[model samples]
Every structure is written in C-alpha cells, then in structure tokens.
Target: MISKVIAILLYLAVVMYLGYKGWKTTQRPTDYMLAGRRMSPWVMALSYGATFVSTSAIVGFGGAAGLFGFPLLWLTFLTIFVGVFIAMVGFGKRTRRMGLSLNSHTFPELLGRRYRSSFIQRFAGGIIFLFIPIYAAAVLIGISRILEISLGVPYEAALVFMTLLLAAYVITGGLKAVMYTDAFQALIMGMMMLMLLGGTYYMLGGVTEAHSTLASMAHLMPSKLQLGGMEGWTQGARFGTPLWLVIYTTIVYGVGIGVLAQPQLAVRFMTVHSDRELNRAVLVGGIFIPIMTGVAFTVGALSNAVFMEKFGKISIAMAAGNMDKIIPLYIEKIMPPWFAGLFLLGMFAAAMSTLSSQYHVGGTSLSRDIWENIKGREASVAASRFGVAATVLAALIWAWVLPPSVIARATAFFFGLCAASFLPAYLLGLYWKRMTKGAAVISMVGGFATSMFWLLFVHLKEAKVIGLSKALFGVDSLASLAPKGSAMWLMQWVDPNVIALPVAMLLAVGAAYATQTMQREHVELCFENIR
Candidate 1:
C-alpha cells in the first residue's frame, strides 16, 4: 500500500514538474499553439504515437480484444502504415509548408485559410466540438475504470483525479507541455509494455508451451486455430459482415488515413524545424506504434494461456476480455509490489498522455475554432486557458455518469464521426484538385448524416429486437423494417465508418464537381496554399 502511494505521488510530481518546465518556456500563442515550430521530429513522433494510444486503446480496446478475439490485430499494422506513413508521404511536407506560409495557428485556421473560407473553419470546428468530447470522455472513463478496478479508488474520485492532473499541465504549458510530457510518457509506456510482455511470456512458459497448452483447452484457441484460425476471413465474413466490416474497415483504415489531415497532427508537421525532422519522425513513429500496439494485441491474446495455466478460470476484464489485462494482471502476479506499482504507472502514463492531447485539441477547437469564429480573432490567451479548463471539467463530469454500455463505444463513435465529417473533405482538400467548396460541404454533410443515421436507427441494439432465438434478439423501431436478430441475421453491416465514410467521399466529389464552375475566393485560396 505504501509503495502504491509512493508510486502515485512520485508520478504526480514528475508529471507536474514536466508541465512546470514547459510552462516556463512558453510565452505567447505561437509557443502554446505550435511549440514555436521547432520541435524535433523524434519528439513529434513520440507525442503523436503517445497521443493516439490512449486509455481507450489500453482499456476499451483491451476489453474489445478480449470480447472480439484476434482479428482486430489488423489495427496494429494499419496504425503504423496509414497513421504514420500517409501522414509523412501524403500530407506532412505540404501541410508544414502551407501552414508556415499562412501563419495559421490551428487546424481549422489552416483549412480555412487554405480554402479561404471561414465557412470551412466554422464547419470543421462545429464537428470537432460536437464529437471530440465524446472521445475525450471515453479516455477519462477508461482511466477512471482502471483506477476503480486496480486501486479500488472511487469512480468519481478517479475521474476527478484524472481531470485535475491533465488540466494542470495543459492549462499551464499548452502544446509544448503536451508534447514534452507525451514523449516522456511514451518512453515509460514503451518500457512498461515491454516489461508486461516479457513477464506474461515468462510466466506462461513461452510461446510453444502456451500454444500447446491452449491447444488442449476448450475455446482457448478459436475453432479454426489451425486453419490460420480467425486470422483468415472469419472477421470480414462473420464478425465483420456488412455492418461491422464497414465499422472495422473505416475505423482501421479510414480513421488511420484521416490522421494525415488532422488539425492537431497537421500542426506538428508545420511546427518541426525541418523536412529532415519529419523524415526522422517517420522512423520513430513507425517503429514505436507497432511495438506498443502489437504488445496490446499479443498480450491480450496470451492472457488466455496465462489464466488457464494459473487459476483454471477465465478473467480477462483487465485486458477488457481476451488478455488486455494480461499486462496489468501479470504485473500484479509476477512483479514485486514496488515494481507492480511502477508497471501500473504505465497505465497512468497512457491515460494522461492521450487525454492531455484530446483535452488540448478539443479546448483549442473550442477557444480557437468556436470562440474565434463567433467572437472573431484576438481572443485572449486567458480565454484559451479558460476554455481548456472548462472543456476538461465538462468531459470529466460527463465521463462519471455515462451509461456503462456507452463508455466503451464513445471513442469508436468519435473516430467514426471524425471519419465521416472530416476525412472526406480533409483528404480531398489535400490531394484532389477537383475538390470544391460545395463538394467538401456535401461530403461532410453526407458522411456526418449517414454515420449518425447508421448509429442511431439502423445499427443500434434496438434494431436487434427480433432474433434467431426469440428471447435473444431485440427489435428496432425507427427503420424502414423493424429489424431484429442476434447480429448474425441483420444490422451486421452497421459499422458507421465503412458505410458513412464512403458515402461522404462520394458526395464530396460529386458536390465539388456539381458546383465546379462556381469558384469562390475561399476555395481558390486553399489551392494556392499548397501550390
């Protein structure tokens, strides 16, 4: 107990110290907004990677892997390739050059200036304001959940704890603090996962033994384990039918690709000192994301072997279901108390690093995007800080009371929304010459509406009112037909990302062309930024 307290206190001190240091260096909007455009590529890479892998990945995804099995492992590869790869090759250099030229301080500013439309800025900000809080809440809820389960802290207290800690650094130092601390947290997180992975492996008697052991157990290995197991087409056909495949594909590749266009991330491209730094970030980000994400997948699955060998019962809640907790659970069992405390701190690291960015981005959107749009530019720094604090507070409170079922899905929903609303317009705005102002709006509206439609009426649990076994299915009321089933029968292709994103893309292009001849000054301005 004393060790745990010590660990927590020590962590708080280090986190605060870092925030204090960053705050000491920051003075103006440029430092707060873009870190003075001088961040190292490696630092940028770590911060980005750390930001992406939040408590949602640790807890919600950990739980997801537990419930869904291994097919989602595809996310590890997709994150590295699309998240980092496309960011560098497709969007990074151009964004950096363009942002620097325009003196843009925020994502919407860049997009707005690029397109020369305050309308686009308003549109983007509105979407971010509407959706990002849900995702931010998911991160907070996930962190609080872990604290509630692991340390026996009260949920509300845990939420408050997370809120206060994140708020201190972000309000004081802004993006500079976020990046510095993110890099440090990323290093700790990387080490902690490595330790957890090693510990799980050593405890479970290594791979050959684990496989041999799982081979003998019931449901340990999926039925098709031998035939490339679930690694085959099972995910796309079975779990990922029309409804989920779209979700899965869109969530994985769609969101991943969309990273290239993110205002928060795009700012990083512009902030770095040189193209050389961005190139170096690619190597650091590419290698690090997989190591961390792959560890989550591997440890999540391996939990089965660990549990069967030790207790003869299944308990994957730590990993969410499969073995997400394989890391946490392993730390509790194998490491000494002090080391366990240290290892668990890694969870704290993941939770804080990711949450800080979300809060920062969301707050920036609120202050810069919404406030600036309505009040005009020249919103004060004090106003920005106040916005950041309020955004964090609002999200923290909401996380405490969110419905149990909704908590896990919140991050996915935001990712889905972003994919729907931003991905189509953002992507085309960067790469497609034919992309018009009308088209961007159409894509944004179409994707946004379709994704929401799929989530609320078409794909919800209510839709499953009628099931194969009458008792098992629940019926949905809002659709053309009252759909019902145990997912297998219908509503399977309900993943908003797959369905909504493509629709948005199609609409954006069509709309852009439909109004092609009606060229606006704003639209022409965007083309000039990149050129």
Candidate 2:
C-alpha cells in the first residue's frame, strides 16, 4: 500500500509540473494549438504513440485477444505501418507544411482553409464535438473498471476522479500540456508492458514451451465461440466464419484503417517544425507502438495458459465470462501488490493521456471551429476551457449511463465515422490540386450519412444497442435475410468501414472529375509550402 501510494503521488507530481510548464509557456493560440510548432521529435513521437494506444488497446482489444486470439497482432502491425509510418511520412510532412502555410491550427481548420469553406470547418467540428464523447466515455469505462476490480475503488468515483484530474490540466494548458504529459505517460506505459511481457513468459515456462502448450489446448475453445467459427485461443478463428469476419473486418480493418482519418492523431503532425522531425519520429514510434500493442495482444492470448496453470481453468471461465475483467484479474493474480500498484498507475496514465487529447480536440472543435467560424465570434482560450468542461460532463454522463462492452465498439464507431467522413477530403485536399470544394462537401456529407445509416440500421449489434431498429423497424437489423449458420446469413457482421470507406473514396474521385476545377490561384496556394 505504501509503495503504491508513493508511486501514485510521484506520478501526479510530475504530471502537475508538466502541466504548469505548459500553462506558463502558452501565450497565443499558436502555442496552445500546435505547441508553437517547435516540439521535439521524441515528444511528438511518444505523444502520438501514447495517444494512439490507450485503455482502448490495453483493456478493450486486449480483452478481445483474450477471447479471439493472436490475429489481433495484425492490427498491431497496421497501427505501426499505416497509423504511424504512412501517416507520418505520407501525410505528416505535407500536413505540417500545409498547416503552417494556411495558418491553420486544428484539423477542421486545416480543411476549412484548404477549401476556403467555413462550412467545412463548422461541419467537421460539429461532428467531432458530437461523437467524441462516446469514444471518451469508452476510455473512462476502461480505467474505471480496472480501478473498481483491482484497487477496490467505486467505478463512479474513479470516473469522477479521472475526469477532474484530466480537466484540470487540459483546461489550464491545452494541447501543449496534453502532449507533454502524453510523452511521460508513454514512457511509464512502455516500461510496464515490457515488465508484463517478461513476467508473462517467465510464468509460462520458456517462450516456445508456453506457446506450444497454448496451441495444444485448441480444443478447449468455448462452445459459444466454436459455434461462431473460432478454432482456438492460439490459432485464431477459421477463415470465413462469422467470428472470423468480425475479428478481421470490424476489429482489425475498422480500427486500423480508421487511424488514417483520426483528428486527434492527425493534429499531432502539425505540432512539429519540419519533415526531418517526422522522419526521426518513425523509429521511436515503431518501437513504442509494438511494445504497447504487440505486447498487449501477445500477453492477452497467452493469459489462458497462465490461468490454466495456476487456477486449473481457462481465462474466460476464471473471469466469469466478463472479458473486461480478464486482464485486471490476471494482473492481480500474477503480480505482487506493489507491482500491481505500479501497473495501475501505468493504466491511469494511459487512460488520462488519451482522454486529455480527446477532450482537448473536442473542446477546440466546439470553441475554435464551430463557435468562432459558424457563429461569427472570435475564438478565445476561455471559450475553449468552457468547451473542455462541457466535453467532460458529456463523457461522464455516457460512462455512467451506458451498459458494459461499449469500450471497443465505441472506439470502432468513431474511427469508422472519421474514415467515412474525413479521409476522402483530407487525402485529396493534400495531394490533388484540382479537387474542388463541392466534391469535398459531397464526399464528407455522403460518407457521413452512409456510415451513420449503416450503424443505425445495418450493424445489428449497434442497432440493437442504440434501440433504433427495434423501435422503428421491429427487427434487429434492416437486412435480416440470412440464415444464422450460413456465411451470407449474418453478412452485416462486417464493419461499415469495409463498405463506407470505399464508397467515400469513389465519390471523391468521381465527384471531383464531374465538378468545376479549382481556380488557378487556389491550386497554386494549395501547393505553395510543399513546392
């Protein structure tokens, strides 16, 4: 108890100190928005990595791995290659140059200025401010569950405590504070996961022996999962199975591809000074992402081995079928109390770092993008602070109101929405000189409408959860024609992104060609800083 208390106090002190430094340094919108465009490559890399891998990865997807097996590692690879490498190299360099040239601070502001359309900025901001609370609530639920199970804190208390702590720093210091603290949190998270990986292997005998043991237990898969097409906890589901489609498309492709359009992650590129920093960041990001995600996925899959050895039962049975509690139960059972405390602190850091960024982005979207642009009012730091408070309240309500298992789906929902709404416009705006404002609007509106329609009417699980299908259509899903056992029967099992992203991309190309071209001067300005 003493060691845990001391560790938590020390962590809090460091975070508070960094928050103070950020508040002291921030004077103008540029400092609060983009850290004055002078952040170190290391800070940017770590901040981006930390923001990307949160409780959603650790608790939510880790829980998925505990059920689905090692196929989740494919997402780890996609996060590093597509989320970090492609995002930074292909997008970051151009984003930084273009953001600076356009005097844009936020992601929505970038698009607004790029196309010279205030509607684009306000529309993007409205979408972000509206949907991000659901994602933030998911993160809040993750940490709250951990604290409730591991530390004996009430879930409501944990949610409130974390919200207050995050609000303090973000309202005071904005993005500078968020990134500085994120870098620090990333270090703690890395250290904890590395310790966990080594500890997991040590407990399960040698690496090869432990994996072989897990592979041998393939037949122990639950009847529920087996019926859905899962083969085992180690070998993954049989391809073309309903469970396989869900794991690959909804879980992997949905979240993986969605990272390309994430507003919170995208804005980090604009915080650095040059492409050289982005290049330097690649190595750090490469290492950090793998340790955070790869280790979590591996450990999640191997947890069954640990449980069977110690408790004579599988991980799912040990946790009473609550996948969310598997990791917390494992950590408590496997690690010493003192070390568990340290790991809990790491969990706290992971949750807070991500929440702070979400709240900051959502708040800035409301105050800077919507109010200032749409309402024809000047954006102010005070207004942004108010927006942050509003975001926190909204997230708290969601965390308190929603049922369990929302952690992973809420994340996928936001990612898919962003990909559908923003990816086409963002990609074309950066690379194509002839892309017009009308095409961008068509792409954004059409994608947003299609994706939301899919979620509310087509995605059966989400539709049921939201209760719209039951109330309006009197069915679980709109297209409920398939027989349960056949592959085509539950076809809506796939994520909307698989369908929505391609639709958005096609509309962008076809609409741009069909519309009038951008003015020559507008085209010249689009390519100004890059050229």
Candidate 3:
C-alpha cells in the first residue's frame, strides 16, 4: 500500500511538472487552445492517440469485449485504418490547413468560420458542452472502477478525487497542459498494455494455445447471450441477431465511423504546424492505436478463458453481470499483485489523458464557441478556466447518476451523436465549396434532433434507461410495439448512427443544392494554402 502511494505521488509529481511547463509557456489564446500551432509531431501523435483511446476504450470497451469476445477485434481494425490512418492522413491535413487559414481554435469554431455562421459554431458548441459530460462519465467510471478494485478506494471518493485532480491542471494550463500530459500518459499506457498482453498470454500458455482454449469454450456461453446471437469468444456473433446488431451497429460500426467527428480528436489536427507533421504523426498513431486497442480487446476476450479455467465461470459471470467491472476484476484476481498497482497507474493515465482533453474541449466550447459568440466578443481566459471547472463538476455528477455497465454504451452514444450531428457538415465543409451555410445549419440541427429522438424513443438501450418512451407510450422503445420476432422489433438494437448518419448526409447534400453557395472569397480563404 505504501509503495503504491509512493508510485502514485511520483507519477503525479511528473504530471504536475508538465502541467506547470504548459502554464508557463501559454502566453496567448492560441497557446492555450492550439499550443501555438507548433507542437512536435511525436507529442501530437501520442497526445492524439492517448486522448482518442481513453479508459473507456481500455476498461469500458475492453470489458464489453469480455462479453462479446473476438468480434470486438473488428473495432481495432477501424481504430487503425479509419481512426488513425484516414483521420490523420485524409482529414488531418485538410482540417489543419483550414483551421490555420480561418484561425479557428475549436471544432465548432472551425465550422462556424468556414461557413461564416456564428449560429453554427454556437449550436455545435452547445451540443458538445451538454452531451460531452455523459461521455466523460464513461471514462470516469472506468478509472474509478480500477481504483475501487485495485486500491480498495471507495468509488464515490475516487470519482471526486479524480475530478478535482484533473480540474487542477486542465482548468489552469489549457490544451498545452492536456497534450503534454497526454503524451506522458500515452507512454505509460503503451508499456502497461504490452505487459498486460504478454502476461495474459503467458498465464494461459502461448498465443495459439490461448486462442484455441478460448475457442473450445464456445458451448460455455451464457444461454442469454447465445439467445441474443452470440456464438462464442473465438467465433463471431451470429449474423443479423440482436447481439449482432448491438455489436456491429453500436459498438463496431457506430464508434468506428463516429470517431471521425469527435470534437476532441478533431481539434488535435489544429495543434500541429503543417501537413508534414500530420503525415509523420500518422505512422506513430497507426502503431500506437493498434497496440492500445488490440491488446485491450484480446486480453478482454482471453480473460473469459482464464476466468473459466480458474473460477469455473465466464468473465461477465465473475463480474456479477456488471461489464464495467470485468477488466478490473480480472486484473485483481488473475494478474500478479504488483501488476495491480502498475495497471492502476496506467488506467489513471488513460482516464486523465482523455478526460483532460474532454474537459478542455468542453470548456472552450462554452467560453470560446458559445458564450463569446453570445456576448459578441472574445471570452477572457478566466472565463474559460471557470468553464473547465463547470465541465468537471457536470461530469462528476453524471458519473454518480449513471448506471453500472453503462460505460461502453454511454461512449457509443456520445460518439454516434457527434458523428450524426457534426460529420455531414464538417466533412463537406472541408472539401466542397458548394456546401452552404444554410445546409450546414440544417444538417447539424437535423442530425442532432434525429439522433436524440432515436435515443429517447427507439434505441432500446437508452430508451429503457431513460424511460421517456415508456412514459410517453408505455413501451421501453417504440420498436417494442412491433410484433415479437418481427423485422421492426430489430430496430431497437440498431445504433442511431446506422440510421442517422445517412439521413444527415442526405440532408447535407439536399440542403446544399437547395441553398445558395457561400461567397467565393470566403470559400477561397478556407481552401488557401492547401496542397
């Protein structure tokens, strides 16, 4: 216990030093928001990767992997190919160039400036400021679970402690602090993940042996999951079943494609100097993302095998049905005692790295994007700092109220919401001069409304929890009104992104054609300096 405390203190001391460095260096709004647009490629890559793959990815989604098994690995493929490769190479350069040209500090500001619409910026920022806390709660739950299991800390105490600790640096030092700390945290996460993978495989025998053992445990799957369409840990989920739709549509497809439009992740592109920096960061991101996500999913599934071998139960069963607890319980029960402390530190890094960015973005959205736009002037740094504190408080409240096993679902909900709300306009704004302000406005509003409506009334996971549909129509989801085992009933399992994104894209295209184009001069300004 003493050694763990010492390790934590030392880790925090280093993090504070980095935070102090960022505080000392920040002399302007650009420095606070964009790191003066001169951050190193390596720092940017690690920060971006770390911020992208939070404790939610490792602990929350990893726990989901424990339930769903190897099919979750498909998400790893998307993290590498789409999240890193396409994000950095295809979208990064364009976003960076355009952000630079327009002097946009936040994601919403980028859209607002590109289309010359303050309303667009304010609306996007409003969505982020409000919905981001739910996502932040997912990450908070992940690390709090780790602390609760590993260090025997009370979950509520851990939540409050982490929220206050993060607010200290993030509220004061801004994006530079977030990125510098993220890079440091990324290194810790990478080393710990590598160790975890190796340790898990070694405990279960060689890689082939581990997989084969897990594969052989197929028939041991819970009857509930089997009925929901799950096949086994090694074999993928059965096609077109309820579990299949949840895994593929919500977890795999929703999060996979939704990553492209994450405000926190997208803003990182603006922190670098040039397209070359983005290109160089791509390789680092490519390597880092696969290691982080791949190991988590692999170990998560293999944990089922390990638990069944030792405790005579599956991973979820061992966790007592709370998927959020699976990874933490596995680490506490299966791994070496010493490893528990290190893994806790890694999770702290993961959670804080992501949360810092989320808070920073959330704060800026409030101060720079929404409030300033409302006031018709630039918001002071003090206001932005206060915004960060407010955001931290909001997230803490959400963490307290959110249910168990909600980490992965909350994350996917936020991701799908952002993709539906922002992707259509943001993507088209970067490349298509014909995309008008009217189209961007309509698409953003239309997408956000559609996504929320579906979440409240149609998507079973959320509708059941929120009880809005139940209150309004006496059903958990509107889809529940359909005949049992009918095609319409399956709509309850389908992710909002599967339905909302295409509708948003169509709205964006149709609205663009129906509206007049932006001024030629402004369009040229947005595209200037592009190669």
TM-score per model over all chains: 0.87, 0.98, 0.99
Candidate 1: 10-residue stretch with minimal lDDT:
226-235
Q: Where in model 1 is the C-alpha error above 4 Å? A: 215-263, 316-330, 333-336, 405-408, 461-489, 517-531
Tens digit of per-residue lDDT, candidate 2, span 1-531 = 677778888999999999999999988877877788999999999999999999988988888888898999999989988998899999999899998888898999999989889999999999999999999999999999888887688999999988998888998898899999999999999999999999999888879988898899888889999998999877888888779888998889999989999999999999998889999999999899989999888888899989888888888898788777778888889777877997899898899899999999999999999989967877888888888889989999999997876788888889999999999999999999978888999899989998988888878768878878778978877767566666555666778888888898899889999988878887787679887
* lDDT value, candidate 3, whole model: 0.93
Query: Looking at candidate 3, what is the lDDT of residue 261?
Result: 99
Candidate 1 lDDT over 262-341, as tens digits, reads 55566678779777888999999898888787777666555655665666654453334333344445446545677677
> How far off is residue 301 in model 3, in Å?
0.4
In lDDT terms, which candidate is top?
3
Candidate 2 ranges beyond 4 A from true positions: 483-488
RMSD of each: 4.5, 1.2, 0.8
For residue 352, give model 1's deviation from the true position in Å.
1.0
Considering summed lDDT, which 10 consecutive residues are worst modelled in model 3?
26-35
Better of 1 and 3 by TM-score: 3
Global lDDT scores for all candidate models:
0.69, 0.89, 0.93
